[model samples]
Target: MQIPDYMVVPSLVVVVIILLGIAFWARYKTVGPDEAMVVTGSFLGSRNVMSEEKDRKIKIVRGGGAFILPIFQQAEYLSLLSLKLDVSTPEVYTELGVPVLTDGVAIIKIGGSVEDVVTAAEQFMGKPTEALKAEAQEVLEGHLRAILGSMTVEEIYRNRDKFAQEVQAVAAKDLKKMGLQIVSFTIKDVRDKHGYLDALGKPRIATVKRDAEIAEAEAVRDARVQKAKAEQEGQKAELLRDTFIAEAEKEKVLKIASYKREQDMAKAEADQAYFIQEARSKQSVVDEQMKVELVRKDKEIELEAKEILKKERQYDAEVKKRADADRYAVEVSAEADKA
Candidate 1:
């Protein structure tokens, strides 16, 4: 078949556009939040490292996108997600030679530093996540066993947090080499084969039970005695209250009687004073009347004496006139005889 000349240029242009789209899609790679993309091959220069001692040619991308050429570089991922491990140790000997069984849980993850990512890429490349988990579990078990061997059984059982902390701390030093770390470690339980813990609790339990019973008995006895004493005190207080009330009532009555007597005495004295004042007023009136009567009698007696004197003078004057008339008649008769 012969190709048309007018269609060749447009078809090449379309082919070029499609190739560019595919190249853009292939070169730009994106990683998830909990994932690290490690690209390693020729032409990858030295990336960020922790120290000058370690120089590695690798590019680690996490939580973002990177440009990766498809031909010369190979890109792989190591999960940054946590790995949960169940660790169990059976018939482990303690520092005091006591054999115990212990169980625990651990949360582990690959370190996120640039140097740690490079280290982890070197150790766990081309391996499954389960392989990483297995390595972490072995390391945790070894450290747990070693720590338990160094402590007593009491220390392991009672201070489980301390035990877990020591184990995690000691294991972290070793795991950092493999670019792994422990987020948390917890002791779940501890057990013994010969019933030592149970035997240790029996004596204390019996003593506590006995003491509780004794305390209950003493409380009952004391409660009864206090109840009796309170009742007796209540009765005595009631009797005293009655006696005091009776005495107060008697005193009130006596005081009322005395006040009434005093009021009556005052009234009698007021009546006597009124009578004496009336008698004195009556005596004063009688004395005034007697004085007026004596003055009238004296005036009558003086008038009677003046009347008796006037009568005596009249009798004397009449007698003197008669004597003078007799003497004059005698003289006249003697003169006639002589003639």
Candidate 2:
């Protein structure tokens, strides 16, 4: 179950009236920014405070709040932000007593001690601009000259690293009695005449540095171009070599084919020689057989001639014998008749 809120109006009225009665005891509040409790008298050493006077004082320097009395003395407002005093002096003399044109920078906020603050307040007290400048020229110039004389331009230029220490050292001794601590001091205008810095010829250095960059870029571009050309030439050579190798391979194939043909032709010649030799041997055998047949035919003819001559001689012999017998018989018959 939800419950409703109750208002205690009678109790709240009593609490408000009780708080208003305590308002007359007198609380202190800094109107602006004051962080620390105000200690009365010179801030260098005294911590002595009357409880009555404590409520009357406050330190109002920067952003924040602190306690103070609603009555008696009020808090003083000192600006805590960075401040500068631009100075131009003409009366300063170097250790060489050479007159110079000088400019100064005073980086300040607030003094650390009451004694320091009192000195700064008295020196920078209310005056017209012309009078203040005149006083700064007379008093501050010598102090600047003395400090700058101990250092050179090189030292001053490089001294920006520990500027606070240098300023503290230079201004601390004098301004300590015046209740001020300087953050830094800067000397701006050091004139060596218009021609002095130009006489060093720094423009040549800049020109040389620029020219070096251009030369480096040019060299890199030229190298890349040359490298690309060399790569192209190498590729061309490789291509030519490949073409030559292909041509050589083709020539080798042609030579191999021609060699094979020559070998075939040689084998054909050898076969022709073998066949011719076999034919000549066969022809010699046939010629021998023909010569033997011719000799046999001539012998047969001679034998036949011999047989015909023998037959004719035998017939003639028989005829002669018969004629001889006839003659004998005639003679015998004639002789017998005579007897």
| Reference-based lDDT, each prediction | 0.86, 0.56
- What is the per-residue lDDT of model 2 for residues 107-165, given as tens digits with 9 covering 90 to 100? 65446554443444445544443453344334445566666566554444445445334
lDDT for residue 335 in candidate 2, whole number 0-100: 79
Candidate 2 displacement at residue 136 in angstroms = 8.2
Q: What is residue 47's positional error in candidate 1, in angstroms?
A: 5.5
Identify the leading candidate in terms of lDDT.
Answer: 1
Clashes of each: 0, 5
TM-score of each: 0.57, 0.39
Model 2 residue-pair collision total? 5
Residue-level lDDT tens digits of model 1 in 111-200:
989878878888998899889989989999999999999999878766889999999999999899999988999999888989876666
* lDDT (Cα, 0-100) at 326 in candidate 1: 72
lDDT of 2: 0.56
